[model samples]
Target: MKKVSRGQRKQTKRFSLHSNSFKQVVKELSKTLVSGLVVAVASNFLLQFFQNQFNFEVAWLFMTEWHIELFILGIGVLMMLYIWFTSLIGNRYIGAFLIILISIILGISTQQKMLLREEPMYPSDFSMITNLPFLVKMMSNTIFLIVLILLIAISVSIFWLIKRARKGKKEKKSQHQKEVRGLRIGLFVLSSLSLIYIYAFNSPGNLVKAAYNDHAYWIPYSQEMNYYNNGFVGGFLYNLNVTPMEKPEKYSTEKMNQLLLKYEEKAKKINETRSKSLKDTNVIYVMSESFSDPTKLIDVKVSKDPMPILRQRMEKNKSGEILSEGYGGGTANIEFEALTGLSMEPFASNLSTPYTQIPSLMNHFPSAVSYFKDAGYSATAIHPYNTSMYKRKQVYQELGFDTFLDEKTMTYADTLEESPYISDHSAYQEVLLKLEETDETDFVHLVTMQNHMPYTDFYPETTFTAEGTADDLEAANYFQGLSYSDKALNQFLEELTTQEEKSIVVFWGDHLPSFYGEEVVTVNGKVAMHQTPLLIFSSEKEKQESLGTISPIYFMNHVLELANSPVSPYYAFLMTLEANLPAFEKGMYIETGEQESKLEREELSSETQQLLEEYDLLQYDITIGNRHAETANFFSSK
Candidate 1:
């Protein structure tokens, strides 16, 4: 409205230009900050989803609290990457898109790994990504839908960012601005290195200690607990470089030779006193899933002894408690010990499932199957579940199983109404079929799935209900399933009694059911949870014997003793160890004159220590180290 002067008009135009530039700068900074924050939040959500799958309340809360710290770290890293990438590429949108894309992919992959394995992502698991299609098939439709939505959202976000970035005008930067950018990046890198060092090597406080510890003992024995106590990211990174088995002290080829010589001499002495051969016997092992005497639980009473026949047979026959390496889960570990004559106790605690980790790597593992195969026995593995679950199909082949019959190949015709798993009766039928089909002696390992967990309506009408517990449906359901298992076992043994061919049946519960609370394990008593009934029946011999308490690793040795089967040097060593440390699993063991207690190699008797060290070294050589097994024919039957 005032009289227009050239100088005043010029000043007003400059002010307007400066105001618009300030707004533009604010908008660009907002885009960068918002994009970084979005990526960070998405990563946190993905990790939370993984935690939720575990269904650990404490872990969920811990992750919820720890995610804030992770978010902050993620934001800082993304911000630095954004600046550096933009500087390098001169395209802010491309840099942002890459950061988002990589973060999304990694987060999704981590989630998938955790969901499938029930453990955080490890470097070893990267090799299993080829099974992604199978994994996707196993996942629920909900997961696929959510994953699709996530991909779409990310694509849309990338498109918006690209549009905004392309619309931005490029300008020559001043030297001062360039110098400032370089200084910021340098400071950022230094800060990042410092944080990484602290995270990896230092225990600053309780929170940091939980997240990471330099101590070797903090390795993931209980993966769920590790992830719960440590944040997901912390646990995952810590396990990335974990050695599967630490070399035993004083381990060398010379030391190994000396140990083998000592054991071989001992074995020779033992073999001199024996005259036994498994030449004509068909050996059958049924590692029943979640099979245990539930009546052992405190304050629990069922309508009938779920395993009356098994209980009666155990009382009269060669039977005892098997101290399992795992509780509720880890069936493969139990099977591994039984078949390989290697106690898992000596390996890294985090090496939970050997089938997934160790056996898959080798072309031929020293196992009961291999030993039997060498003895002219055809070995067959039968499991009524997906062949790909735990990668058992491949593992069986590596373990020298001539044939693997999984769910797809099984002739099992019936399944329980309440459960998707094949009935135990049907599984036994398949075992009998295999026995009849084989003209030569056979070694059949049948891993049943009828009694597997999530005992949710595993039985349509609960015939055997728990009376003492207040509305414990899970216990009732578990008891009913066990009753069915007992009936199936009785039927199978009865049928076996009719067969004329001499055979040895080794029946054992892999681990206890996870129906009751986890606290029930330690609270009721150690024996109730850790001990499962193990019975070895001989069709030709009627004599009854008792093995007080033993580990699953000694199962085949006991079978050989009962059947007078020829023994390998490794198994001979196992037999001797079993006589001394009769019950030894992961944590607890029973000494010759003492009750079951937590034991360390250092606390063991000198003789026991020497034996365990030799055992550890032998197992490490065969499983993790350069196997020198063929030099001594360690697995060959004498």
Candidate 2:
């Protein structure tokens, strides 16, 4: 006020400019951070909404849960870190783009998982992306359009945000630039470590375990329940960790030695008493897709018995119920149990498919193919579908198959009239060709694809319709498909019977078809939806004996037993286990003299418990444990 110099006035102006610049920077940061957090929250709500099938009550329940709030908070922290990191690099737009893109992908996956009742997308699922061209055909127009819109919107938003950020003038270098850089680096490292710890170990007192007690801990058994109990994000993070298989109680080299010795002694006795041999017989295993008889379903009535031939053959052949580990899907797990003679019940629940997780981890998998190869038979697998589906091409190679015939390679792969999948008739024709091509006794593993799911209006005309019930399109479509499968089965059997070569045809349904509604098949107060029909037939017309209900783990063992074929000590151990315990699937075991009682493993007798312990130890050693498998003849033909 007394005398203003030009220099002082210039200094005062500079201070004012600096203060405004700081305020503008703060405002921009706040806007970007808040927008990112909003996007994260909205995406989570959308995921829950879709996953719960737009059921407001279930969606609300998920949102109201305390654990879900923590999950949201975790997602927010991740978004904030991404935004902050991108902002530091002068490209906050990329962070926004990534957020939107990931949200879209997760949303679609959640919807699919809900529909399929399958586990969330794993690293292995990405290998199936090659089948997207065919898979996309199965999607509805509405879903396809919605996804398209989402992608377009995301692209526009990303472009707009990037343009806006670029339009803003860059801030001048600050006096504490080094400090800001150091802080940003420190925050990034800290956030990364926190995320890794949370996802890797389920930290913060193991929230997943706290939410779900011991019973619901296995995610693959009931993934839907897991998601409902734990929030989507929480459940996903919990399942991300693939824990090492726990060693059987008191497992050791000496313990394994004792079990091997006991089994070796039993094997010696069985081999000495063996009467028949499967040396020259061609073994054909047909895992028909969704080939269960709907007439066995209780709630709904069909117009006629869809599987008349199978029912008639059941009386004259060695046919029975197979307690499949999967329902509707999970063919790979069912095949794994059949091929390896190893029950998935003992492995980690998250190890959903061994073909994807186990075979890749192990140097060699001692499978039925390897066993047959050792016994002087060429093993070949045939699937009338994409070889890349479930990574089967790689799996078959590792499993030691001499040849694998897939959709691309199969000569007789022709689609059915009302279905996109290859017909069982055509698949059986390929089986005949393989039999003709190979002079040696071949182990032919055929997985049919005629009756795969999506029981929609694919059939222009329906031959069979649901009777004694309201009109249901899904049921009618399913029945028609089942009818086709039955006819194919009859034709295949006729061809097999006429063949001059002595062959054993093991036919079984992989699992029941997933119906649209809640009307599931049940038997004796227990859900029989997981059970499928199995038939073991011989072209030579051997004595037909009903095997009753059996677990898939004992499938190949029974095949060997019925053939009176020589088996290794490992198989002898399986025979003993199967003889003692009634056939059962995971989460339920049939007790020693109780055909109907389904009890937990803990409820078994002391002797049965010891046998189970030995089984678990041997399986662990052969699969997840050290290379002690070769130390004994557990997987050898000794």
Candidate 3:
């Protein structure tokens, strides 16, 4: 052994110190990276599980090529965040627990919503935090228990981690801690920048979107499919849609005025042929909740017809179907379309529920209530359910409803057997009461709650049986509810006939009921899945004509036409739209009676396409763009 000099001894110690510091950094980074990898991977899986059937194989089929990259981005973000949070707390275990707990909570919520609504959660949904208590009441006890158990488990885990971390905690005398501090600071900054960049813009050229251009599917008609194609993180980020869409290319005041002028002339031409008017009749619209035709929408082979009266009327009366804006849920959106004569499809993909999402953005509120009120009718809106849902009270008040009645204020707030909602019989009876109260012509819009989700055995006894693995318990229960609704409607019609005033009851199913698997819906066909029964019956006998297929956007137009009612220019445009495009849902599916109902606008006549584009322009102006039509006499009195 050679005797070492003082300088060499110092150098040896310095080298060892640097090497140990490097090892410490590597060790900490490796642990973070591994934990992040597990979290990100598990989160993506949870997202897929939420959107798809819980079956792994089914989820696997929906994964896109961009999934891997999405996970990479998610992992990077999580790891960087873990590193920074751990450094700040000086405890890796606690930080890890916090991250895991938050991610798991989000997953639980997304999964619950997906299972119930068949729609992915959006950031806009968080704004509904104020209604958390009421929403909890709406959830099934099983889901609530699952959430409770998860929270308890996480609490126990966090407690254990805290105790363990505390036991190992020590006062540290630093050995050149500057480099480690520098490393953490860099990570924190990098993480912050990365997050800001990813979330800042929803433009096509955003870094994340550009990188996954191969699978950048923004115009997803089905938001569930959007999540299926995009990984959880990517899909969630997609819902951070600050901009609804780029402004229309020709969205100028002059252009809008010109379009309105053309429609105004069309309205005059339509008015020339009309003899009677909606002004003279009491227009009652019943937007039956989840009141879909299962026999058609799902092709459910039942022991008996669920809605025989509706079917009979469908064959004889001016009845067919309207493309529902929602499936399983989105009753409000369907109502919004029918009430306002605006299509949901024209709005951005993220404006899934316009009643909640887009209403706040509107400076002018126009609906059937406005048109009816203009015609000197007492416009009353009724929903025998939560007043806070979709913020209906505020929306209705703004829409100029003379009276808005919810469950809290309803005269008959009775519920059927085992059902949480008000029964269709009681709901119709409430409408009958409204009709009797007022001698003046009325415009009554009733959104019944008799057929909402969690469709178990609502009816005590039913003869209906459906074809399914579990004998289609949900479908059977739904069919039974429909039977009850059918009886209620028949009774209501009889009651309407007894009334002295001439009246027209426009009844339609908001959307299909929940419980059907996505696979079943897909096999049945998207257009078929979305089409719900639309019946326009009157108090007195009238000519029955098949109106073919149509959408809720054109619903009021049909109502006006069937009633021989005068039309506003806006109604005239919608009438033209229905003529060109008989049925439309989210702009993805269109049914022209001549052609087999197609899923796209690929093979349309040029004139039809132009009309549809004009419809988009009008809808965009109403919801997102300027109120050009408000000034151009588009909604002028007939």
Best by TM-score: 2
Ranking by lDDT: 3, 2, 1
Please estimate how well model 2 matches the true structure, expressed as its whole-model Cα lDDT.
0.72
Error of 2 at 385 (Å): 1.3
Pairs clashing within candidate 2: none
lDDT of model 3 at residue 259?
A: 94
- Candidate 2 residue spans exceeding 4 A from truth: 1-32, 65-69, 72-94, 118-124, 140-199, 202-221, 361-363, 467-471, 521-526, 595-599
TM-score of 2: 0.87
Model 1: how far is 2 from its true place, Å? Answer: 29
Error of 1 at 354 (Å): 2.0
For candidate 2, lDDT tens digit of each residue in 167-189?
Answer: 86677886545544554565557
Backbone clash tally for model 2?
0
lDDT scores in order? 0.71, 0.72, 0.74
Q: TM-score-based ranking, best first?
A: 2, 3, 1
Candidate 3 residue-wise lDDT, 19-115, digit = tens: 9998877776677667666655555565566555456765555443436665566556556556656656756666676666656666766776787
Name every residue pair that clashes in candidate 3: none
Best by lDDT: 3
